[model samples]
Target: MTRSESVRRAGIENKPSSAEMDNIYYTAQQLDTKLLSASIIGWE
Candidate 1:
């Protein structure tokens, strides 16, 4: 699934651009944490 989709699934109404979302996913992968949903959702 795309990062946008994943973020949406996490219940974030406002979202960043596709590029920004991709960067977040990439950074999360680098950190090896399951904070993808938490981090993005928390930004809301």
Candidate 2:
């Protein structure tokens, strides 16, 4: 499977699994960090 597909599958498998195993949440946080960095650069 593709990387995105794997991540999606991991998300599905993570729900109702446990907070410690939430790949989607971690991925979203990482994405947020990148977005924040981009926005900061745009402001400069």
TM-score of every candidate relative to the true structure: 0.41, 0.49
Name the weakest run of 10 consecutive residues (lDDT summed) in model 1.
35-44
- Best candidate per TM-score, number? 2
The true-structure Cα RMSD of candidate 2 reads 6.1
- Each model's total of backbone clashes: 0, 0
Cα deviation at 41, candidate 2, in Å, is: 0.4
Regions of candidate 2 where Cα sits further than 4 Å from its true position: 1-16, 19-21
Point to the candidate with the largest lDDT. Answer: 1
Cα misplacement distance, residue 26 of candidate 2 (Å) = 0.4
Task: Write one digit per residue (lDDT tens) for candidate 1, span 1-44.
Answer: 99878888999886578999999989879776556656876842
Model 2 lDDT tens row, 1-44? 88768878778542345665587689889999999999989943
Candidate 1 deviant stretches above 4 angstroms: 1-13, 33-44
True-vs-predicted CA distance for residue 22, candidate 1, Å = 0.4
- lDDT value, residue 25 of candidate 2: 80
The clash tally of candidate 2 reads 0
